[model samples]
Target: DVKVTQSSRYLVKRTGEKVFLECVQDMDHENMFWYRQDPGLGLRLIYFSYDVKMKEKGDIPEGYSVSREKKERFSLILESASTNQTSMYLCASSLQGHEAFFGQGTRLTVV
Candidate 1:
């Protein structure tokens, strides 16, 4: 089964602290993505990596960044967590956009 697993199911943090979220996939997919979802806002891409050591800033990558030093793992970093950044973070992997699998999601509440 193609699966993506997130490091956390829930995270609570105060404003102005750095946060790290990890993700792993067993499919060896070349494309991995990080997205934040909110009610009625749909999924907004934060960052994506096409291959190891290569990354791209997605639509909503203002306060977020990513790392992909290993093919099966990707990490998302929030430089300064804020209440406005609270949302469900989802990790996804796909090969050429054909049927992407998502992690369970991490619900982050920045207070």
Candidate 2:
């Protein structure tokens, strides 16, 4: 079974702080994605990587960045965290044209 692991289940940070959310997948998939979920906006992609050392910006890449230095690991960085950036962040991994396995998610609150 494929498993996605998130470093934290919840996070709290002060405004203007830098934050890092880490994720890892056991399935050795080539594609990994980072998304932020909000009430009305649903799941909005923040970034994705198809291969190690390669990354692409997704729909809502503003204020977000991603790194995929290893095949099974992907990291999301919030350059400068803010109150409006508070949301549930999800990490997912999958093969091309396949359904993704998602992590338990990290709920972030900025104060």
User: Which candidate has the highest lDDT of all?
Assistant: 2
- The segments of candidate 1 whose C-alpha lies over 4 angstroms from its true place after superposition are none
Query: What tens digits encode model 1's per-residue C-alpha lDDT throughout 14-107?
Result: 9999999999999989999999999999999999999999999899999888889999999999999988999999999999768889999999
RMSD of each: 0.8, 0.7
What's the CA RMSD of model 2 in angstroms? Answer: 0.7
lDDT of 2: 0.95
Name model 2 segments beyond 4 Å from true.
Answer: none
Per-residue lDDT of model 2, residues 1-111, tens digit only: 779999999999999999999999999899999999999988999999999999999999999888888999999999899999999999999999999999999999999
**What value does the lDDT take at residue 48 in candidate 1?**
92
